[model samples]
Target: MKKTAFTFLSVIVVMTMFLAACGNSTKPSNEGKQGSTGNVNQEAPKETEQPKQEEVKLRVFSTFGGTDAAREAFAGALDAFQKANPHIKIENDVMSANDDGFRTKVNTDMTSGNEPDLLFYFIGADANEMINAGKVVALDELLDADQEWKNGFAPAALNFARHTDGKIYSIPMTGFYEGLFVNKALFEQHGVELPTDWEKLKTAVKTFSEKGIIPLSGPFDQSHYLIEHFVLAAAGAEGQNKGLVDGIEPNWEKGLAAMKELYELGAFPQDAATIDLSMAGNYYSEGLAAMILEGSWAIGGWKDETKANTTVLPFPAIPGGAGTGKDVVGGFGTGFYMSTATYENAQKKDATVLLLKHLTSQDTIKAIATANGGTPAAQGVEPDGLPQAALDGFKMVGEAVSISMPIDSKVTPETFNTIRANIQPILTGEKTPAEGLGAAREIELANKK
Candidate 1:
């Protein structure tokens, strides 16, 4: 165990160093479209009897692998796109998706001034840095110009594509909810019906506790995804709540109390912060816990790992909650992004538009999601006849289009480090949640300044 952990840690360190090295600014100039009116260097047509054709290929760098289920599902769609555009050849490369690792590689590529024609990267949640750095192209013109395709997507999904500047960057890949993963057999064994609110949940958990079963499991490894999901659940159940805290930014305060409350329940294993993210996905298989608060990706992992009688649902409504039991808290996952650099290069720029348009089609998205175990982004591809709770959760978010909060991602990256390390101790009584949150708030405020 120690050896395995050491190896993982070594890889993480290397990726961190690699990403940090990418920040040196020696960027390449944008090559504006060759035939477009936008560039100052637009060339006049030569007096030739026949129009000359321009040749270009789009290079796609992905964090997705060809063998990945998502990629498998998307392969046919991509083949169709290639058939449609003979001029655009796609070269797909899969890189690591560890947050820091992906960031480092992309950062290095951008700083080298040769950004990918398109990035299959996380868009909305992680776009703050990319948008601020002007790495992402503003797609407002492309989107607004396409009234037909623009109306094809649900508005809630499109809302995340907009930057604070009100310009669009990338369309969403797919949306998911952070919810409770249940071991139905365990609840049945304990004779504890699912609890509808947090207090009753505490009772149910305690009942399981007496039988020597851990009631919940989580991974707080770095970003505190487990804890953060609980916060999102509480926030969704609480009126899709956003409040103005004097010292905090837009998303800082909404779910703090709920996170603290869950920590107090002693739900997770000891030293959960030090555990690997993959650990919680195995809980039901190992019989460690009754449930988990996680996203749809768990569906893929669990099906591959175990055959336990398991299911998923939205977090039970918070006691005295203001929102429905099915209220969900997450945004559509990111989509492909065009590079401003590609748009500027006359030869390379037109290739960017062709590929970007093809990648956003309903055909491509549905195939990718079907293979990847997510509910698809296309309007007609929803999950059918699952638990009513799962269906309700999915529909609620579609209707409300709740603001997708990047609990940890929204704060500064430096602040991310501070809170990531401290979440477990603070949640489990070693430190008060208020104190820990205050420490995080301090770092966040400093970063903003």
Candidate 2:
């Protein structure tokens, strides 16, 4: 009996040792997962680490930096874009919108391979040149990729945006309209009717001049607004298009001669030969002038009282002229372009595109249009709170048989300058209309080479 008891005690001791070994192994395995929670707390950063993102910097160059209404509108829109896109930084270099040398500045930069990521400029000849040089990106694919954004643009605007290659490099923002901004108060004060036809216009000019008030305030030496109006009004759409291309139309001579006739009739201010756009606009705004042949861009600068009494109407028909009396000189004036480098750079491509979209978006463009008193490139832009003069200008364009682009825009810079320079002499009887236009045509032909 004693020997049996010893054997049972030995078995019990072995069983206890085996059970202890199993518990030790199981405890360590369970602690590895649960104790890891504690370890995770200690080394928390290691599990949540993320790759750093590089900030993208972009340079934007534009001509909307002056004290004009468009300046404030563009600045506000740009600020909004920056706020929405914090990761992308924009450095804007703004120049004067009226600076004729703006194109020269852009040309110098383009030739030196120093282009901004984005550029705001005219959409026609220069835009086509940039596209041809591969400086600007063709946005057809980008536009097609987003139909909602594309559809927001008017069909006419999209056609205007495209180049001969059927690819668009620019996105138009606002359209411009040219007309006679008449001060109805001044007309009533002079006992003259608002001119809607040639005979009434002549009568009004005679009455206003006799009263010692400037009949029409225009810049004779510097601006092409008058030339564009008179020439397009005389040539009509088909003839104007032909004149811009092949040669100066016969009607162009008539247009130039008509200016002289008006000058002889005392239609313009005595100091019109020396005045610039600002001076003319000031005269009209101060109620000292009967009318100013200007664009929609000038509406914002009109005095509050004058703007209330202002009305925009098409240039009166020139007697025996070929133009449809209703045709106006105006079109999509300014557009934004993206650099090819911006598109090729993987870093800036997406952000630059996003910025361009934002700048040309429906809301932003409509705001710009409202601020500038011009038409929006986007469709369905409500004319909320638009000045009567502005609405009148837009109405004139809508009812027009066809809108003619500015003659200066279609001509070479040198030829345009020649036209501007000789206008004073032509109106003063120093140069014949035929002589002036012939000289301009020679320059145009030479420029074609």
Candidate 3:
């Protein structure tokens, strides 16, 4: 669910108090959208020691195309950070999200002993590997020293940061919550009273389909997305499904109920089975889809395309429990991680610390937050109010269930393949919901063996 700056460098280089660092100047690479530098502070922390007057460089591993407006804004923030520190130089290296480029690059670097000081990575097995190997530094001491940074975040907001040792390896980029992104005008035009819960959502899908509108701009290609939706729906049925406040795999029944409902609703496209994450935004934009269970990241897409008015809201509250519309399904955005190895030199380490501190400043976060159409992570730093729809979209991310990110890479490749290929059948009605769900789960279980 996240990317930005982090490293996969060969485990941590045990450093003494020496003032010099290890020599890899090149940046580590990423496998998703690359994003680079910026500085912001909700509460100012002491500027760490500076590197010597000699030229110093900090590498950036990001997902941004690096030439886009958003990237430009981030770059400007880094420029400002350098100005404040007067010693840090930044080398921004961009990478592709295609296939396993990011992951491959990270694995190769870590095993090769040449990992970049900072690279973008997701939290799960990928991070666990580095953390387990004792390559990454835990942020506990830093958080303790800077109470402000800890205060800036919501409790449990950075849970993914925990290493096997119960330590924090990385700082969370930003918090994101997931929900049903519905096309308001489309639903109204089709006389589908927005769904309030399981029954209502199903009925709404049926209503939308009857009017020739596909009810879902599905992410069946991201098979876990389907599982997430069904699970959420079943949780709603429980009146207060605790598992849903954060995405969870409770009894498979919850997910089963949700999928069965969607299947019967006939809400997805003819090729729902084939749709991937990329299509979710586009489908909604083109008016080919009525709803999508996506994260706030799609807000930009809806704003950028589509003529119909779009508004995202939480999935209908489950009947009777504490859940219904009370929480979300995702978590925050991206952030950067510094390499203790690269900062080995006293001077380099000082500069790196200053740059890292600057990157999280309020001014920088505000700019990046705005350009990407994101929410500011800095405490009390509010963004300029945009259209009502946009504001509501931001609110949706925090109001829904907490994020429970799936371990996409932990399962067997074959199981992952089946999920990517087979889940679509039920989504498109090519197979029964039970058959589709069973097949996918069966594969996952098989992989565990």
> In order, what lDDT does every prediction score?
0.57, 0.76, 0.54
Writing each residue's lDDT as its tens digit, candidate 3 over 1-449 gives 22211210100010010012325232211111112223444434458433346777777676544222256766786777667545567877666342336666776776677666765566544565666565556667767876655665433435445654677666654444456777777777766787656677878888878878888777556655555545554444232222221323444444554565676667677766555556655777787888877655456545444523767676664443334454445434355665657656665665665555556655555566565555455444444534455556655543333334442434444544564565656545576545654565676565445
| CA error at residue 222 for candidate 2, angstroms | 2.6
Best by lDDT: 2
Error of 3 at 407 (Å): 6.4
lDDT of 1 by residue, 61-99 (tens): 776652243655455655666675565677766663533
Reference-based TM-score, model 2: 0.86
Cα deviation of 182, candidate 2, in Å: 0.4
List, residue by residue over 1-449, the lDDT tens digit for candidate 2. 01123332332232233123233221111111211234445655766754545789998899876646678888887888778666678998888766667779898887788889999888765555677789988888998987777877766666666666778878888777899888998888767888998788888888988888888898887667888888877877667766544766888888888878888899888888777777878898899898889888788877899999999989976777887788787767678888888889999987787888888777787688878886677665553467888878766765676676777667777777888888988987889988888788888888677
TM-score of each: 0.73, 0.86, 0.70
RMSD of candidate 2 to the truth, in angstroms, is 24.1
Candidate 2 residues lying further than 4 Å off, grouped into runs, are: 1-52
Best by TM-score: 2
- Name the weakest run of 10 consecutive residues (lDDT summed) in model 3: 8-17
